[model samples]
Target: MLKIQEIRELIKLIDKSSINEFKYENDGAKIVLKKNGSGESQLAESHAQPAAVQSVPALQPQASVPVVQQQDAMPAAEQKEKVQDETLHKIVSPMVGTFYSASAPDQPAYVKAGDKVSKDSIVCIIEAMKLFNEIESEVNGEIVEVLAENGQLVEYGQPLFLVKSE
Candidate 1:
């Protein structure tokens, strides 16, 4: 069996690497790690034990039926909002971590909605594997929305903010 620290290290290494899946088994203990298309990692573990076998049933094929698709009409306001959203730039997380809106508990948040920022502006921080990384806004714009809350667990490529670029 792997220790908690060892598992954490393995997760960090796998997340940084290009490998999509890993499996290990030893002394009836098994561990599996997988990453999906969305860049999120999943961990699975099992301790093997003896079990009784049972009979299973087979499935029969069913006839196929034609499918129809319907689209709902959107309100004018919603359509306009969507169009504006499309024009906004999204600030996304580069790695999975805990999002921090400020440098410390007593400090003010780095940026808030309606705050104007430059391409080099530091917008927030993400803590991963005990390391705090400052995240920068890559676009010059006004922050239109803050998508992640303070101390929230964020995933890689997850949008953190929406900005209206200048």
Candidate 2:
């Protein structure tokens, strides 16, 4: 995630640029920086809030999943194993920002499902205040699931990826 100092720099750059709005996205994070006619800069976060609202109704229909209901009384060990089998680790957002999977529009994505990563590997980018910051993996693992989608706004501490740690 872009630091506060980096955001300040980006705001300064926006003040000097002719652009009234700047938007950046990677993975599922999104940052939208806007300059009003009076030249006042404002930062807005983008997320799946609208989609979340829509998904609630869709999930209601799944209440009849008898299999899941039966699993509610699972043994402690089995429950732990089931959870472990699902995800070994999560890559979370350090700050509120837009997530980007690649450096640029034409660039290939840094990683995808089944991709392996080391502790220092660059997994994605988070843009805050018009500045892009490369986010590194903190664990050695293979990506199991990408939780966020490109251009989605992610909140601080939001899970961005699920990794099966090595």
Candidate 3:
């Protein structure tokens, strides 16, 4: 298995490059990252037996990765709506994790619709591998919508919130 830092580096490199897909396999472990037409990327990892297995090893369950295909164009009405909302910016997840609207169950949400935020504001939290990560708003804007529900599973690059720029 790749270390967390290595995985982070790989994600950064892939996001900055023109490549839309990347795959790596070693010692029964595999990692795949693919980008959709909208430039959002999804990550998947699994362990597989070697092609030329000489002996049967302990069987382990495989991780399932959902495949989603997007159409090239939206319906006319949707397209018109999208055009009108072109100024909205999406705050996407930096990794696959469980989305949390607040730090704790009793705590209030970090931000809500209509809340004004600056470029460095914390918008939400994403828990991955038992670590709680604070997600920042990279753009100065007013929160328009919260896309991910509390405790929902979010994929890498999945949109968590939409903001209208100031």
**TM-scores of all candidate predictions against the true structure:** 0.60, 0.52, 0.68
lDDT by residue (40-118, candidate 3, tens digit) is 5556666675554322111112235544655346688987767756768999998778899999999999999999999
Q: What is the C-alpha lDDT of each candidate?
A: 0.78, 0.72, 0.78
Instruction: Name the 10 consecutive residues with the lowest summed lDDT in model 1.
Output: 53-62
Highest TM-score model number: 3
User: What value does the lDDT take at residue 6 in candidate 1?
Assistant: 65
The C-alpha stretches of model 2 lying farther than 4 A from their native spots are: 1-82, 85-87
- What TM-score does candidate 3 reach? 0.68
Models ranked on lDDT: 3, 1, 2
Which should have the higher lDDT, number 2 or number 3?
Answer: 3
What value of lDDT does candidate 1 attain over all alpha carbons?
A: 0.78
